[model samples]
Target: MKRVPLYAAALGFIVFAGFPFYWMFITAFKQNRDLYVGAFDTRHVPWIFNDPPTLEHVRLLFGQTDFLRWVANTLLVIVAVVIITVALAVPAGYSLARLVGRWGGRLGMGIFFTYLIPPTLLFIPFSRVIALLGLQNSLGALILVYPTITVPFCTWLVMGFVRSVPWDIEEQAMIDGYSRLAVIIRIAPRLILPGILTVVVFTFTLVMQEFVYALTFISSVDRMTVSLGVPIALVRGDVYHWGSLMAAALFTSIPLAILYNLFIDRFIQGFTMGAVKG
Candidate 1:
């Protein structure tokens, strides 16, 4: 039947897409003996059903490395960036939506376009600025650098959401003896919740995943973020610790996965609203 091929194709695509993650999970538990065996070797290497799996890699990662410190540094920088982005972008977005004219739209577009500039191009100058400010090897350096990407896109996204909100309701609240700021504080809350959540999730993810700035600015072991710490701890000069590396990767990804699942509905709605309006 016609539906038979469609079902087969869907199953095929899922298998193809999921195989890598499945392999990584399996390999993370695999011992060095199993890993060293050739794939073509018919020596009965029980990769799939291998029991007595080791947690040595995970243990080594947590026990030997500054992983906890790296995680703390990443969380701190991400929290700071998220707070700064929300504080600056929300009001700026409202202004562009309510006060400014066509020029405001152009300005918002321009700000968003700045984010498209590759970080590689900006790193040298940014490094010089950091050096001048004496922030070299400090977590504060990441705090300053991360906002370059977070603010612009967030402002544009919030601007679209703000524009979509009906102003009549806000005006009525203002007429009912509420000050302008109070009306915005109260009525805007319901409508902008999705947009704010979008900003927080996107900004946190971006800051967490960023590498170039972190690599360039931070060299001290104690001050590194998770993205930088993983490679440094797991990769030696010519040797690679594949097991520990995969374990660290798996651990890092789990929290983000949970967060995405928790607020997926609002996240989707926020992005949809921004896209349709913009």
Candidate 2:
């Protein structure tokens, strides 16, 4: 009987958190009339599916917009960022964990602090740098610049997770004639996979949502990331393609949502343990 309240609370929380996603999902398929007809209909719940769903919006999203290119570009940026973040963060994190001694924690903190610095503050200088490199409106510029934001925080997160590994075991391996590099290479990966997975997901999601850099560096329609391309191409001044906009958003979000759900256990395990042990 006592568990009933707990169950109700959990259900309530799930609905609270998940309702927006549900609405976004259905709105993508709803016809324009079905959407607007209920706006002031106090008798109807606005988003409830009263009329039959249609794929017209989905069709329009693909037919009229460069959604395919946006997907390709977004994927390219995500892949590049994930590779850079994991490759750089793992070694840098391991170094901070084992090699840097007492100052390592402070150094890691400094790195993370850089991630906290507002993107707004640095976009001006970043734009200048991008211009100087002659990558002002290029997807390549995003691939190069995204690492600056992704690596620091992921490295710090990985440093904390690595710190959770037993030093006594590492020392025993060293005494057994295994070199430091060998021990790290063999053992670190085995134990810190959850942390690495967390970094990949985090960095991938960041690339998807990142706006300022994508917006500033990619002005050409063909070059835009999904984050920038959708809104730019979907809405014309004072005129919004709500249905197609919702469709674009839904399709783009579904894959990431599934990926996150698949590895959610590892992601949570890495974060909770890393925070406490770090």
The candidate that wins on lDDT is: 2
TM-scores for all candidates: the values are 0.88, 0.86
Question: Global lDDT of each model?
Answer: 0.81, 0.83
Candidate 1 lDDT at 246 equals 81
Clashes of each: 0, 0
Off by over 4 Å in 1: 40-47, 261-278
Instruction: Please state the error at residue 77 of candidate 2 in Å.
Output: 0.9
* lDDT, candidate 2, 86-173, per-residue tens: 9999889888888999999889888877887877888899999989999888888998889988898788878877877778877888
| Cα displacement (Å) at residue 69, model 2 | 0.9
Candidate 2 stretches with Cα past 4 Å from truth are 1-12, 41-45, 236-238, 261-278
Best-matching candidate per TM-score = 1
Error of 1 at 189 (Å): 3.6
> What are the per-residue Cα lDDT tens digits for candidate 1 across 1-278?
58999999999999898776666677677777766577778865645734567887788778987888899999999989999999988878887887787788889888878878978999999999999999999999989889898888788878887877788888888889999788778877777887888889988888878999998999888999999988875677778878778877878877887777776665554446445423
lDDT of 2 at 137: 88
Q: State the displacement of the C-alpha of residue 40, model 1, in Å, after optimal TM-score superposition.
A: 5.0
